[model samples]
Target: MNPTARQYDTVIVGGGPAGLTAALALTRYRHRTLVVESPEPPRNAASRGVHGLIGLEGATPDELRARAWEELGRYGLAERLDGRVEEITPLAEGGFDVATDHEDTIWARDVILATGVTDQYPDGVEGFAACWGRTVIHCPFCVGEENADRSWAWVADDPDHLGMTATAFRAWTGDAIAIAPPWLPGADELRRSLRERGSDLVLGEITRLHHTDGDLRAVELADGTVLERQTLLWPQPQRQVPLVERLAQDHALALNDGYVTVDEGRQTSIPGLYAAGDLTGKPWEQGVVPAVTAGSAAADAIHFATLT
Candidate 1:
């Protein structure tokens, strides 16, 4: 069921860390906030732990969200709605009419968009999906520590960060190998850096992942050769949520380098429309803490803006 409020001071979409924290901050200011969360599992649901968040390290994603919900419950000003947003139509007069899959409509003076991005993985690789978040990981700061000191491979579909990313992993696993196609940019320079940094380089695409119950054992190359690897870092690209794409393309909300452009206040180009969390910044800026910080900052801006 949805909240009965016909109008709200602020309506937060996506009940992740960013949206929840935004609501929490708005509630402290005595504003009636509505939090609309999708029933779908979070983007990080497959991961085992929520790393890089201070004091809450190693906690599961669900655990972190549960704690956030528990704290949000204490604030009577915020109402939680369990449903996915279907559309957001901005009224010409002002504010917005938010529609949900449950067929409920809520009007709000301000909208905070906290929908995050979706990671795109490589296709046509056997067992790749099963090994994700286990042996096949993304950010090293999040999952590499536990899998360190074993046979490791840093494979990149794109070689833009090959030199920096591959060389930086020496501390975690000194014998890690950097793998990329031979024809990518800076290939020769990457080879020199890897050699200087005490690492090897492999030039081929991964064809298959050898694993058992998500524990990766080997990575097969297109050349039909298999290399025993306990951990793999295949840095892939990510895309914005459908809502974000729609707003950018249809409504002309500005985008900075493929992400929603926000000023210092975290409000989007559209007045009274704000965006936060992983959906608003570069891939490198994405993390639990950044999302929470962005949400809180956006709430502060909205509170002051609403006052006048």
Candidate 2:
């Protein structure tokens, strides 16, 4: 260990909603906490604003983060360090040593892994960059109600997913279109359900998207067929960040479907090591509100565990 390594009660990796929330709770409890955030933009950086969070509805991601940092500063128990965690080594002495890109080492009695996931968007799709988060959304509930009654399209990797997603989009609008790529699986039941829901199906591979100023106008197919749509629901897959993976592998933390496995209190399999937020492998808990709740819960658990 470095002779000058800073020590804290807890060291949290990642500064997204989960990490910041945990830091806030820890600080409020007067626990010495250190938050290490990467210089890179968060996964939700492309989104214009966050949804599903009351009192902060429509708040941009940047705004939410800025406000969170300000709140965390009030307690003076938590400090933010701008750097990426390169490695986390569990010390035999019962804490952990965290190494960062800034060449600084931090030792903490407990480590909280709040590193979020990364979204994988489709490649070679025109206008995707501009329309993403604005018109090209993933979860219908996230941006669906905001763009309700508009022409909506659901893009999925398979016929079953397309049918299911399109059917769900019907809650927001009646004019839902399922973009069924040519490679989609042939499922009569799914096709029937789509038709039963009055959702139109476009059978072709999307080659490009036509949009203006982040507002989607239409998607062009490989056959040059253009289907007009105002909003698109394309659920992108998510993967854990490198730091989470490294910690899981190095510490032998349990994982389920690539997400960290945590007990009800957000504690990982390893004692003194905890996890929170999206990395917890719960699909229904991927939103901002849930992330905040998970962080607070993890802090509470850690506090209680330390007392014993």
Which number leads on TM-score?
A: 2
Q: Rate the local accuracy (lDDT) of all candidates.
A: 0.84, 0.83
Predicted candidate 1 versus true structure: per-residue lDDT over 132-234, tens digit per residue = 8878887777677878888888887456566665567766886688788757787787778778877767788788999999898998999998998999887
What lDDT is obtained when candidate 1 is compared to the true structure?
0.84
TM-score of each: 0.92, 0.93
> Evaluated with lDDT, which candidate comes out highest?
1
Across residues 1-308, which tens digit of lDDT does each residue of candidate 2 receive? 55688989999988888898899989888999999988998877887788878788999989998999989878888888988889888877788888889888688989999888887778888888888878888766677777888898887767656756555766788788788767667745666777876776767777899988988898998899988889988777888888777777777888888888889889888888888888885544587878889999999999888788
TM-score of 1: 0.92
Clashing pairs in 1: none
Worst 10 residues of 1 by lDDT: 157-166
